[model samples]
Target: MKVVLINPPHTAIGSRIPDDHLPPLGLLCIGGPLIDAGFAVALIDADLSDMPLNRIVEEAANREPDVVMLGHSGSSSAHATVVALCGALKQRLSDLIIVYGGVHPTYHWDEILRDSPCIDIIVRGEGEQTVVDLMRTLKAQGDLHAVRGIAFRDPQDSAKVVETPAAYMIRNLDEHRIGWELIDHSSYSYWGGKRAVVLQFSRGCPYLCNYCGQRGYWTQWRHRDPVKLAREIGRLHREHGVELINFADELPTGSRRMWRTFLEALIAENVPVLLVGSTRAGDIVRDADILHLYRQAGVIRFLLGIEAYSEATLTQIRKGASVHEDRQAIQLMRQHGIISMATYVVGFEEERDVDLWRSLRHLLRYDPDQIQLLYLTPHRWTPFYKTAEHRQVIQTDTRRWDYKHQVLATRHMPPWRLFLWFKSIELILQLRPKALYRLLGHPDAVFRQSMRWYSEMGRRTWLREVFEFMFKTVRVREGQSLKTFLGPTLEAREYALEKAKPANSARRIIPLTESR
Candidate 1:
């Protein structure tokens, strides 16, 4: 069977630079089983190529693949776009077997397939084994109902039926190739010309954040062998010339001993790579030495889920951290000279207007290197999703799935207040001299360059008006190409739209299973 794996275009900084990004790990993990089974396979990283839907459709049509698999991440816009992509492809190519797999699909599996006839199957939970098994069954012309971890529609009847394909746990990390051959070494970078790649050292999450869908899948956490993970990073740097690597995991620092060992190995290898990913703030603080070792291992930045400031709100949201602990972690990351990208949530059910200000105030006080404020989204299958679904939290348009651009209905605060508050905070942060200096590094030279970029956008006033109009309406103009608004003028606007793209562009082996 000929299979095509894709990483669709996503929202990110739109600077043109040489790509030295990681390959799609999820696609390749699934691809690994197929390759062993003697199947023809190819990967299309639309993220790396900046390919539009039409281009994606064109390429898939030309290849005439038996199965087309696409991956997505947490962002709603990206998932919706993936659904649209699958729908469009199925429309053009009736014989094609389109599959959707990712974090979003596991809980929303039936919803995705039922909503769109274009999607024939959705591989729930981990996809590596499920996808391979699916292909094997399809190749042998067997009944799909027999597959375990995958869910597909009932073709014989109008009513949709689902199936869970058998699950295969990957206990041996070294057994898989890591799909190094599938990666195109030349095309990846991060946050303005920083050469970046990602390596996952583990899978699954042990704790449940009410907003997270992970709880619906794996019940506990799992770790890759420390030695093997370290070796993979060393190999990428020594053989592939990788300069920066983001260890993409639910928590890269999940296991303290394993994480420390991996860091020690990186230090020993003397590989100059910037390591970045999400980590439990408490883990870094509890094991300060491990963090020091991380700094030595070129650990640079990490995203922390300090989702709320109110203790009641935190407990309500199940963030699993006290205010004191969260603060300590932020301070510790600072002491370690590691850049902290803190994420805060507004629009929670129990949150008040005063609470929103207090959270913002706390953010300003901590003043991490950067902060991202997200209107709480109850993605499907999450506890929050289930609760919010019944309470009228669903936003008006699916386009609002771009959480940055639109807040669907909120639990307490009006959607407009949430939007205005975030917008105000972003503008204020951008205007801060210290923030600007950090953003551009060198003031005079970079400031002029920044001005030029803004000027270019101002020149495209009509386009800018269209974008602002869309934000106002929370509806995209009929036949509007989102690409035109991807850069500076539409910076915040596009962030939500483009972020809809999946993250597998940087690392080839992370399947939709892990990311979604």
Candidate 2:
């Protein structure tokens, strides 16, 4: 059997930087199983390729595969693009079997199947196993109902949804292959021109942050073998010319002892790749004793999720970390000479100008080497969705949900005013003297050049987004795409904060360490 896996191009114009693109780990992971299962597989990373949908469709059709699978790493925002890509492909090759899988697709299967005739199957959660199973079943012309972890419309009765049993999660990470061989290392980079590839030390998060869909998707927390993972990074650096490793894990630092061991192994190998990923602020402060180990292990940057400064807002979102922790995390990262990138989210239902001011003050006080201001992305499965589903979504165009764009209509401000305030905060924070000095006047050439590259990217993207909001009709309130969206929001009660993974409460993998 032949298979084609595609990572659809991003919908938002400013969301991608060509040189800094990372390989689609989700697509690659699924590709791993397809190869081992003896299927002819071809990989297409549309975002990095910068290919238009029409071109992507043309290329996939040329492959003439038995199945064409589409998945994404950061999926909620890219749902619409995948749908359109599927539709276009279906028009060209009416007999083609199209499969869409991701966080957004998993939950929105009913709607997608009903509205879009193009998508034939949805490999619902943890797609690595599902993809392998789905492909095998289709090749043998077996009943799809026998394949677990899939949602497809009944062939005989279209009104009914055939949701098979959930796919069992891969417990021993070493067992599942990661399709590193499928990626072209020359296509990706980070921190300027350093060649990069995406890797994962672990999967899922132990913490319960209300707004996150990653946690729900991953089901539970688990880590790859420390020694094996370290060796893989070293090998990629030496053989594949991968100089930077962008981690796809939600939280790799869950276990202090294990994480420390992993770092020591990487440092022992002496790989100089720039390692980067997002982790909770608490982990940064908690790992203070071994701070140097992170730098020695080539972790040049840590994006701490400092979602908010106010205790009330933090509590409302169940962020699980206090403001003091956020500040101390930044300080610790700076002390170790590792760049601290703090992410602050806006667009909570109750947020106002006063909240933005408070956040700005906090950012200045924290003195992070970099800060990213993201709008709230309330994915359907997340707890935040219940609170936001009924509210007016101004940027209803599915692609604009990329944390960069404001989505929900605010209670205190109109769409235009919110956009203006949002853009103003970025200008004030990033254009200040200290930031400018670091980018332009730093003594270290490497630091200055890297900072300049990143700052320029941010500046250009910010400007693009501002212009988009002002002139792009795609984001206008009247131009919303969700006209069929009716009232009653999905009811989501909080599962046991300490237990019960979403959907599959029967089977859950408790992380060896959640205490740290």
Candidate 3:
């Protein structure tokens, strides 16, 4: 069997810019197993390539693969683009089978099957073993329903979706290898000119942040061999010109001892690739003494998820840290010359006009080298969704589900005013003399170039958002918006989260594993 997997060129604001592109590591993961299964496979990162749909069609036609698969790790926002790409592919090759797999399709497989005839199958949850089984079943003309971890329409009844039970997550990370040869390294980059590739030290996060989907999707936490990971990364640096490695892990620092060992191994190699990742702020505070291990191992940046400044908001989201810890983490990173990116999320029911200013004041006091602001996006599968379901969606289009869009109703302000408030907070942080020095006058040219590129992207995005808020008319998906272009009301006001019971509080006494 022959297969071609496409990381569809996304329509998100980030995708529109060439310098902002990152390689599709998810597609590469799926490609690994398919190659191991002895099926001929080709991977196309159309986003990095920036190819038009027609040109993608031409390239796939040349390969004449028996199957074409498309998916995005960031699924909710990329659904429309995938659907459109499927339609174009079906039109071009009448006999081809199309498959998609990701978070959104994992939950809404039935809707996708009923709505789009072009998509033949969806592999749910993790894709490694599922893709291999799916291709084998297709080649042998076996029953589609017999394949685990997939959803497809019954041939006899097009309206009926045949969904196999939940796929077993792969507990052993080493078995799933990346098909690095399938990717052209020159096409991807990070931190400006550093040739980069996305790699993973672990899967899943242990913390129970209510709004997060990673904890649910991964079900448990696991890591790869520390020495093996370091050796391969060293090889990629020495042999393949990979100067930077972006970790796609949610919690790479879960096991502190293992993390330290991994760092030591990489430092021993003395290959100075810029390593960057997102991790909980508490992790940094825990490993303060070993901060030198991080710096020695080439960890140039850590994006601490400091979702909010107040203890009230932190408790509400079940974020397992306090404002003090967040500030300390930032200080530690700065002391070690590691850039700390403090990310704050806006748009909770209880937040009011004063809350924004309070947050701004807190951010200035905490003062990290970098800061990012995002609207809280409620995914249906998350506990946060129950509280958000009744709220009106301002940007009803699935494409806008990216964290950039404000999805919930505000208590005290309209959408435009809220956006203005958000922008104002951004300006207060990034426009400061200290922040400007960190961004524009950093000692490392590569890091400086990256910060400037992102600054350019943000400036354009902010202006575009202002234009949309003032001029563009959006049609809400369901409930009526508070205004012609904003969100609907959350019936329950002044609500806050109770302290969480414990880890796995809602589950049976089963160990956190693949079968959860």
Output the number of the lDDT-best candidate.
Answer: 3
Give the Å error, residue 129, model 2.
1.5
Give per-residue lDDT, candidate 2, residue 401: 75
* lDDT by residue for model 2 (275-359), tens: 8888888998888999889988877778888888888878988889998998998888877777778888887755778877787
lDDT of 2: 0.77
> Model 3 — TM-score against the truth?
0.89
lDDT of 1 by residue, 1-516 (tens): 889888887643221122334556677677777777777888888877678899998988888799898885533556767877887888888899888887666555555665677888877666766777788899999977777667776656546455543344555555665555666675766433455566778766666677765544554466788877777778888887777776668876778888888888878887877777888878877887666787788877788888877788778878787877777887887677677777776656545577667766787766666666666654544556444444342334554454444434544666556656765665554456755555466344433343333334323432333356345555322322212221111111110111122433221122222222
User: Can you write out model 3's per-residue Cα lDDT over 388-485, one digit (the tens) per residue?
Assistant: 66566656776877777777657577777778888898878888998898787888765566567667767777777667667763744354532333
TM-score per model over all chains:
0.80, 0.91, 0.89
Clashes of 3: 0
> What's the distance in Å from true for residue 179, model 3?
0.8
Which scores better on TM-score, 2 or 3? 2
Q: Could you arrange the candidates by TM-score from highest to lowest? A: 2, 3, 1
- What ranges in model 3 sit over 4 Å off? 18-20, 440-457, 460-464, 467-516
Give one clash count per candidate, in the order shown: 33, 0, 0
| Predicted model with the maximum TM-score | 2
Residue range with the least summed lDDT across 10 consecutive positions in model 3: 507-516
| CA lDDT of every candidate | 0.64, 0.77, 0.79
Better of 1 and 2 by lDDT: 2
